[model samples]
Target chain A: MLVHHLYSGGKDSSLAAWILTRLGYEVKLVTVSFGLLDNWRFARETAERLGFEHQVLYLPREVLEKAAEIAIEDGRPNNAIQFIHEKALEALASLPEVGRVSDGTRRDDRVPLLDLSKARSLEDRFGVAYIRPLLGLGYKTIRELTERLFIVEIRESEELEKADYEVELRHIMREKGLDPLEIFPKRHYQSRVLGWREKGI
Target chain B: MLVHHLYSGGKDSSLAAWILTRLGYEVKLVTVSFGLLDNWRFARETAERLGFEHQVLYLPREVLEKAAEIAIEDGRPNNAIQFIHEKALEALASLPEVGRVSDGTRRDDRVPLLDLSKARSLEDRFGVAYIRPLLGLGYKTIRELTERLFIVEIRESEELEKADYEVELRHIMREKGLDPLEIFPKRHYQSRVLGWREKGI
Candidate 1:
């Protein structure tokens, strides 16, 4: 019954680990470091603080170098989602004991379900079980729970605001005034959508 | 050489149609009508004014009825990107001409490349070609061209603010401080993304 909390010492991952621990799951915190020693030390330290078996895996430095290029592709480049999945898989591969890979996945994140795809994909690709305790809960709830649990602030995820990549794309299309989501695709399928304000049904 | 400008009668698609016609593509405009005759009539009239052969294809109606129900799950939900893709595919399927489907796709819209996967799947499944002519242009430039060409304007697309599902999803997530694009991708793939602030990378 080795349950691994893919911990990055962040709020969501740490809190998820905390929840599973309270549930009597034998928890191991999995942190992957990409040459950031401070982060590496903090994640390892936090895992120990939580009284869980802890392990640190170093990510290949190339991943960080490549992230920006992946982030700013002009045409249909695989977004951050794909890169994150690959990196997680790599980390999982290097772990000592991984029964089920759990983490600080929450509804507050983009396409909350997107993780399920990545996890399922990882499971299929690597034969690992990926579980998320915080799937349906929204941002407000996640924030509340994090505070209630006294978990470390969920702050690893940093959105580049104002005239950044997303904003840059928005600028190009916003005045043309398209829905950023339509072009970017929040929905992955092509289904007949109802609730539309169509003139005549 | 029947080139159907898959017109939403909106800026991007209309602009795309405008370009290919000037390139001597012998373009014919096709507007897929689902859920609204008045809207289609309006779109159709715009196509006619462009002096191009216009064809209107109606969706099966049931698809529209199910989009919202399909977007959500037991209080959890998917995003709008899925519905748009589903609708786009439905429209693409009914294209009568055996050539290819063309639309107002531009360089910026090329990121997730929804059309990439969709076109591949459609071509593999049905051998339909999905072509985007404004491949390299940005919205600012497209707007300038639309003015130059005197393209008919559809205020509904503008007033509707385009990507209704996405805007709604953004509104839903924003109340809780969610990233709109991530929420929107719920429809396409459920790949979890980890964000880094302050070299959170």
Candidate 2:
């Protein structure tokens, strides 16, 4: 009955957690932290505002180290971020108490997308249900739903600095003497959940 | 916002309607019928048990007639059913009061599946959000969720006689002097939601 949502402190994952709760699943928001930055704490704050239990899942630096290598070699962040997303999902699915693991990857998502075969492989191997509440939805529809159900703050992805693989991946890239902005795209807007709309939409 | 869910009186659509309601959408369960049979009335009873507003959206017989031609010509029901599913979604999206249209199409569904391009096209042309709540979930996961949430009756597709495109498609096939059993897979099982589990899972 309990589902662990891969929380990024952003509107998408926050909305996913809310949806699970509404579907009668006890949702625990978990942020995977590689210890590159303190962004997970920001996710914790957002989770608190949403009134859900939040926890930080710490992975060894090596998991992200490999992803960084991929990013540097490929001269792009998409594949590296995707690798991290899979690792995060695998880690969540491996938890003893986690029967269902979810994320906010939508239909339009590219960098951190999990394909169906990979998702099914995780489920079959780990004996956990991989639930993606936003997978059926597109970018515009997600924006509409979030606008209806949440009070969100939108800013440039770098300025927002929410808890996600990109934050830590960018840090690793910078540590390796590569400018993240050059490697990753600019003008990317990230949304962080402020709280629910006081008066229902 | 109000969402018109294409209801089949089956567990998938029923669960989709429940999910939409939980996500704070005013859900109207609509059964798209070609009037080949009275199966839509059966869906109405199930919708009543679930306490949602139910309506029957009647399509012109010619639509199913086209689909029937495809099925009989192809010697299979998959493409034919898929054709009907698209038409049903389009009809729901075109309704004056409907700003959001959804279906019970899941990740593993084959016959009635709508690809992302088609879904987006519907959204663009109809000015409605094409929402598929179960799109991220596979058949096994759906079975688990339904077990937790509703009391479902499982039987052969022919015996169940649900208000889905398949039911009407089969009727048309029989009327055209083709045996549906020879066309559709014989071992296929259909589930109908009787009511919610009293004590919960």
Candidate 3:
């Protein structure tokens, strides 16, 4: 089956893509750009190295802003991220070639989580299957698998300059002369994927 | 330090003992018996195989009955199991050589858990440090480590013929002509460690 995987070039996403490839699925790596300071350069590099068809979907600034506004109003990033993720899935589902959508959402992930209600709605509305390959696996399992399968470089999310919804939301807050810290608290132990070496068996 | 580890001859306890040994601690394995139909044969066998000093402490039947009564009263096994666990810790703390007591409690374990208040009281009153080596590690991590470190035999709790508080509680219900099934529901995946082969590095 043709599976459009939401790739962020992170360890979890990379591992999920690797699993799909191993499972004999025709996987297409899709990374969404929210018009942040960073781009999908590393994601493209990862896709090339892993040898999968890659695509970059640019999300409009207004959509991202609307999600950010909701997040700010709710005083939590989780709601905002989930909103953005649903929108991204909707965009992917609109494509005729994409019969299924998948992401790297693991058992431990709280944000960007497709709740059961939302998942059911998407499947019923678009007649598309939503799959999360790593949903059963926890954080430690994912990290261990990533270490064994690929030579990965781990860095702080900020240092990696990876394009994500949070970066754009922070930028919007800054542009409006509002304290980003008030809207979004600093997260600890947020590791971002910089690059990878040889794919270990 | 001489640490008395509560050994059940199960995967979690065995893994906990393995981790403690790796950490260079003088470990003593203790298996508590509540005088059920099942015996401590496998626990003794595991201790012999692992080359640790093994001690089997007999828990009074009345104590187990009291805990079981409480569980029946509350209609929950968690509180009852926790009570039994605390009593076991108390018994271990009374030992002259045992400066600290440890257990196989992992991050995923809900029943038989030492809550913060109980843990604090144990430490303050008895001056015994309670250590749970596998407390930070989840089921996936523990299972992965068990697979890598030792050759394990997995089976249901009933099939193992191992003496545990649960068995004794059920026995008490059976003696009173009460349906044990009503009190303790059948658990699907209860793996007991029959034995291990060569210990991996």
lDDT of 3 by residue, B86-180 (tens): 89989888877777788887545677876556765776677766766665443434555677566665555563465456767777777878776
Each candidate's DockQ: 0.01, 0.67, 0.04
Looking at model 3, residue B98 earns an lDDT score of 72
Residue runs of model 2 more than 4 Å from their true location after superposition: A156-160, A199-201, B156-160, B198-201
Among all candidates shown, the one with the greatest DockQ: 2
Candidate 2 lDDT over A82-171, as tens digits, reads 888888889888989988899888887776877678878989999988888998876766887788888888776664367878878888
Candidate 1 or 2, higher TM-score? 2
Best by TM-score: 2
Compared with the true structure, what per-residue lDDT tens digits does model 2 show for residues B138-174? Answer: 6666887788889988776664367778778888888
What is the TM-score of candidate 3? 0.51
Tell me the lDDT of model 2 at A184.
76
Error of 2 at B52 (Å): 1.7
Candidate 3: stretches off by over 4 Å: A1-201, B36-38, B156-160
For residues A90-161, write the lDDT of model 1, one tens digit per residue: 478445565466656553344223443454455666655555645423343345445545433333322221
Measured against the true structure, the TM-scores of the candidates, in listed sequence, are 0.37, 0.93, 0.51
User: How many clashes (backbone atoms < 3 Å, residues ≥3 apart in a chain or on different chains) does model 2 have?
Assistant: 0
